[model samples]
Target: MKLQTALRLIYPPRCVSCGDLVESDFGLCGPCWRETPFIEGLACDTCGVPLPGHSDQIEHCDDCMRIARPWSRGRAVLTYKDNGRKLVLALKHSDRLDIIRPAGVWLARAARPILQDQMLIAPIPLHWSRLLKRRFNQSALLAQELGRLTALSVCPDLLVRPKRTESLEGKGHDARFTTLDRAINAHPKRKHRMAGRHVLLIDDVMTSGATMAAAAEACLSAGAHDVSALSLARVAKDA
Candidate 1:
């Protein structure tokens, strides 16, 4: 066996999606990688939610109109289930910085249709307490990776998570919205940077949409011409 191969075997890389052993650092087994749902076809032009059972020409899911998302549009590379949850947890808790590169590259490629027109990238910032506890911000890592893939500048200081709130576990939509409504603030120093720019707000996942909503609100308040969101995954509403 080749020395490099033997050394790799000694350390045996594991897949991020399924935890299967692999020979390289791809973070997913070939099958799991292929199975990750890349949201496609005619989706809601506003929210990126797939229009199920509709023709390819269909656009705008009912939820988009009912809830009224603040961002102009958004897209996610995966549904937040199965392997996606594993990958997200690994990236957020296990310090898998390498995951950011491939995932961000994939997300950028998936979002090419819209992201190509965006002028600036800003990550949804974490509250200082959360950042201190985690020692890093997953959104920042994703923004860096997306910047590397898209050649767009990542402005990290544009948004600030001003206050920490209790965990959102078991929270309903109204409660989540209330908590997030008070958590984010626009950085005054960076307000001028948003003027007349189409901003791409990057986050690791879109759950109840409250966090992104707050961030997008801050961006709009700072004078961004328009704002859009791109996330690695979206939490599917339970059936």
Candidate 2:
């Protein structure tokens, strides 16, 4: 028997969410897949939130219209609820590295609409202290996987968080932005790679978009030609 087939038979592929046996790796079973809120149809051009009805022209959600998004465009793979939420949490906290493969695939699909030539993939930075606690940055993992799938260059440390900000959880929208403001900056040594290049920022989840805005601003200030964002999941208000 072939080595690949032997391995599969010995250790069957399992669902990423419910841990049930599945036909393929890094996938969800039927029930879990159905429960997952994969974003589809018409969505905001800036935030990737699903909007009512359809339009040929680009659309923006109320939040995206009201808030200042430093990135030129954005997309998300899933709505932050149900199985989507579970997948993000698993990757972020449970050390579920297996999810990266499926996430990269989904992110690649969502990113197709906004992809630019010679795009540089980078991840939202985590404070050094936080990085020490977590051992790894989930965003960095996602960015690396995305770069591999898309055949783009990945700069895992393109951005840095010199200062650690408190958690944005439970904080109001304005406060979240205020807390993250000026907190993210481009790495001085790596700024040369970002100059005059289009940058795509990756993150595990986007809530108020405060973190993405800060990272995008940092890239722009560092002389990036343009900035765009891709998140694994977006915390939609109605979701």
Candidate 3:
């Protein structure tokens, strides 16, 4: 308690999104808080996209019905736009560990329905070359923090990315999948841990779902009973 007080006095508190002053840590200023598009209310059972109007029973989104995801379940806390996109960009460029605290809290609430006692949390790994340059994997940070909050164990080493694929920034949908094909797999020595167990894969963003699809397939091929994916932000056409 004393330590927190002293730190607050020294560093003060700032909004993780807009860098505005706030009352305390892990918070957003009033304007920034309202600006953030937090996904809540009725959402898709499969992809976590907010549904139109109100519903009384479980429902899946149109996209989930037309296109199937490799993972059995999925969750996303916010749409990948506006403040949400800014948050991701800030984490990559600036030293903002505070961003993960609020992200983990939002993710924990979104993933509550899929989390289970025996499930394991694993992050999508960056290729060694990229990891060396970045110094840290943002996805792993989110997974570790979320694991602590949810009392779930995280296995950061369970997955391996042997080759660094080209950036998907300017690629078409098919091109993106071609790049990820056979690019991700479970570590041979760690396969035993995944078999017959549910694995929750974590990532920073889910733009087209290609990365998570590959991760889910790899885990399933290694005998995982089921795989689910969650991301902090997901690109969407609408809520």
Best-fitting candidate, scored by lDDT = 2
Report the lDDT tens digits of candidate 1 across residue range 10-54.
Answer: 777877667688767766788988776666666666666555665
- When 1 and 2 are scored with lDDT, the better candidate is 2
Residue pairs in clash, model 3: none
Give lDDT tens digits, candidate 2, residues 213-237. 9999999999999999899999999
User: How far does residue 231 in candidate 3 sit from its true spot (Å)?
Assistant: 0.4
> What residue runs in model 2 are displaced by over 4 Å at the alpha carbon?
none
Report the number of backbone clashes for model 2.
0
lDDT agreement with native, every candidate: 0.80, 0.94, 0.86
Instruction: Name the regions of candidate 1 deviating beyond 4 angstroms.
Output: 1-14, 19-24
> Which numbered prediction scores highest in TM-score against the true structure?
2
- What lDDT is reached at residue 105 by model 1? 70
Please identify which of the two predictions, 2 or 3, would achieve the higher lDDT against the true structure. 2
The better candidate by lDDT, 1 or 3, is 3
Candidate 3 lDDT, 59-174, residue by residue in tens: 77877787778888888898878887788878766757779998899899999988899888999989999888988889999999999999998988788999889999978778
